[model samples]
Target: MLVGIPLDQSNNTVKPKECASEMSAYIVEVAETRCKRSFAKVFNYFAPRLRSYALKQMGNEALAMELVQDTMSNVWQKAHLFNAEKGSPSTWIFTIARNIRFDMLRKLQNRKEDVCSDDLWPILCEQTADANEASLDQQVTLEQIGYMFESLPVKQKAVIEAIYIDGKSQQEVADELTIPLGTVKSRTRLALQRLKGMLHDND
Candidate 1:
């Protein structure tokens, strides 16, 4: 495993869960022995990516870094709770970061409650399903989403990535992209429809 976080990992789209068994071992070691090396490996590999993801969502370097710290702290504290059968570390870690970002957004957008991130992008939950209860837990891995998101048209994809993956408000996306708010909304709606159809077709 890498001992230090790289300057950039944009080209390494497939690395996160590609070695799930290996990463899982690191997580286990961190849990059982509190090994700093193992935890460092996890932090070294994921911290950069998590920061980038958080930066996109939160739109500030300092806030993005906070998300990374908070997420790694949770991974350290909750490693024993991880279940490999349910999801890989990438999924678990990113989900934690996303939920944290959600809370951060909620705080930041106190005046914009009429426009919500959850309405634009559904949050992924890692809960196990009950014996008699159905759940909407996404089994789709980050790699799958990376490829699927790339399939969108340039305009629609930009809007979707900004509002959906990045956790931006529709108005924020519109302002950043210099497009009309209605155009952002229209593209987002169309993009989601296509994405849901693609997901069902995959199923």
Candidate 2:
């Protein structure tokens, strides 16, 4: 969807610029040439994502949308300052969004808070809990290695799974599989090499 309000309000305000470049450069030229339609189109394209990003950081949808509008307005007014050679259009636009977010946070800090301190603790704890869950998830990923170990040929897969996943020694796996020690070693090595090649080829 196009971002922000419809172009009916902003397009008629500017003239069109010639040629296209990065988004930042395009925005600058559009504003300079008074290309109202182009300006509105560009604003719409970027507004939704920008709003979502702002809201994620600020925890307020309305405020984020306001910031998106403000950022677009700034883009129109300050397009001339954009330098295409230095960065991509999206990067430049995002930088503007980021700056706006930081400014809003700073402004919020100056105002007195109405909410009780106890009300904020849950939100803070939620954030902390999210971090903890993510850490636990990393340790849980031992199963991915287990799955990879299991998904091999019966002998090759069995020997590797027994030795690695099941915590058996090489001699134990060989004895269990009733294969020679050297045969077990050879199969494990060949299986690993083939797995690596398959993975690299997939990439």
Candidate 3:
């Protein structure tokens, strides 16, 4: 959902200046303008995922709910502190979740409720940093691929759109276009080659 439409890093757009990561653009918007609509989008998307993550770590529905609420509160409060150069939005958000989990567990331990620090599994900040790097790279690459689709020749674009975007099989595309399957395959292959060359040149 976050990947398809690249925006222009404004209230009305998604593309950021340095990177076209959608979440990052959203975060930056929240930071600069305190836009509740953007914050709500962030909340709606990440809340359930954070609840699942917190439930896995804490093994309690109540704690999971708490984590989701607290983590999102921190996200809104600290959105201005987000540095997109360091890690993706995922890592930043999860790091907040991890810290909240730690604090929750630590408090439980203080009450002597059988929780122990030794049993805790904290998400390593560095590890998540690397993971988010790969994630950010993948997002940018996908955006570039979207750009590539705009440059395809008309016939090739039709074929590629039918197969990939419209989720039609090659045979289906062949029948729809009244062309043989072999011709469909050839057009697909040539369109892919052009996209490959574009990728290489961009690199």
Who wins the TM-score comparison?
Answer: 1
Residues 1-203, model 3: lDDT tens digits: 55644333243343433332777877899999997767766776678779889889999999899999988998898788788898888887887888777768879777754443223543322232223433323223787898899999999999999999999999999999999999999999999999988877885
Question: Between candidates 2 and 3, which one is better according to lDDT?
Answer: 3
The per-model lDDT (C-alpha) reads: 0.79, 0.67, 0.78
Q: Pick the candidate with the highest lDDT.
A: 1
Query: How does candidate 2 score on lDDT?
Result: 0.67
TM-score for each model: 0.48, 0.43, 0.46
Lowest lDDT sum, 10 consecutive residues, model 2, at 121-130
Clashes of each: 0, 8, 2
Say which prediction, candidate 1 or candidate 3, comes out ahead on lDDT. 1
Total residue pair clashes for candidate 1: 0
Candidate 3: the clashing residue pairs are 7-14, 7-15
Error of 3 at 18 (Å): 14
> Measured by C-alpha RMSD in angstroms, how accurate is candidate 3?
22.4
Per-residue alpha-carbon lDDT of candidate 2 for residues 18-131, written as tens digits (9 for 90 to 100): 212534555766858967656776776678768888888888888888889977887787676666677655666777777676657767788554443224332111233223
The lDDT ranking, best first, is 1, 3, 2
TM-score quality measure for candidate 3: 0.46
